[model samples]
Target: AQSVSQHNHHVILSEAASLELGCNYSYGGTVNLFWYVQYPGQHLQLLLKYFSGDPLVKGIKGFEAEFIKSKFSFNLRKPSVQWSDTAEYFCAVTAVSASKIIFGSGTRLSIRP
Candidate 1:
């Protein structure tokens, strides 16, 4: 079965800090990767995606992720983050199954002011 797993269920940080979350998938085929972020008080929004071109993709609000086929993972990373970046992050993957995407549970990010 195709599945995605997130490393942390919740993360806490100060107003200004760096953030890195792990995301792993169980599949060995052509895939489309995505990272969706839901702000503290907002709906879900796309952070980034890896379709076919570059393995390194950058997204809104200074967020990015790298797709490592060997590791079967696509990890999200941010050098510096702000309180506004506090949100619930979910990693999703779409394979050739022609079915819906497989999304990891999620990682809740909390930024303390």
Candidate 2:
């Protein structure tokens, strides 16, 4: 079974606060991981990715994630989030043979100004 899950269906935060969203995947083999963000009134963008190498990968907009192989998890985090950071976050994974991606349900982050 290969699947991705996001624990937080929705999240709310005040401006300038730390943010963390949990993601878990069910897969037994090597895979590619990614985090995509969709900001309010904006298009979807790639936040980061983990194809290989370091487990701790950085992405755009001051966001980062650590891939834990043992736990089958890739959680997104930010030190301090702004109201502008408000968006819907998705965790995704893919196999070498699979051309398409497997996406988590999603996490909605609403940062209050």
After aligning candidate 1 to the native by TM-score, how far in Å is the CA of 44 from where it should be?
A: 1.2
Task: Report residue 96 deviation for candidate 2 (angstroms).
Answer: 2.0
Q: Which candidate tops lDDT? A: 2
Which regions in candidate 1 have their CA more than 4 angstroms from the true location? none
- Per-prediction TM-score: 0.94, 0.96
lDDT of candidate 1 over 1-113, digit per residue (tens): 78999989999988668888999999878899999998877898999999888899999889999999999989999988888887899999999655798999999998898
Over the stretch 11-86, how does candidate 2's per-residue lDDT look in tens digits? 9999888999999999888999999999888887899999999999999889999999999999999999998888
Supply the TM-score for candidate 1.
0.94
Alpha-carbon deviation at 96 in model 1, angstroms:
3.6
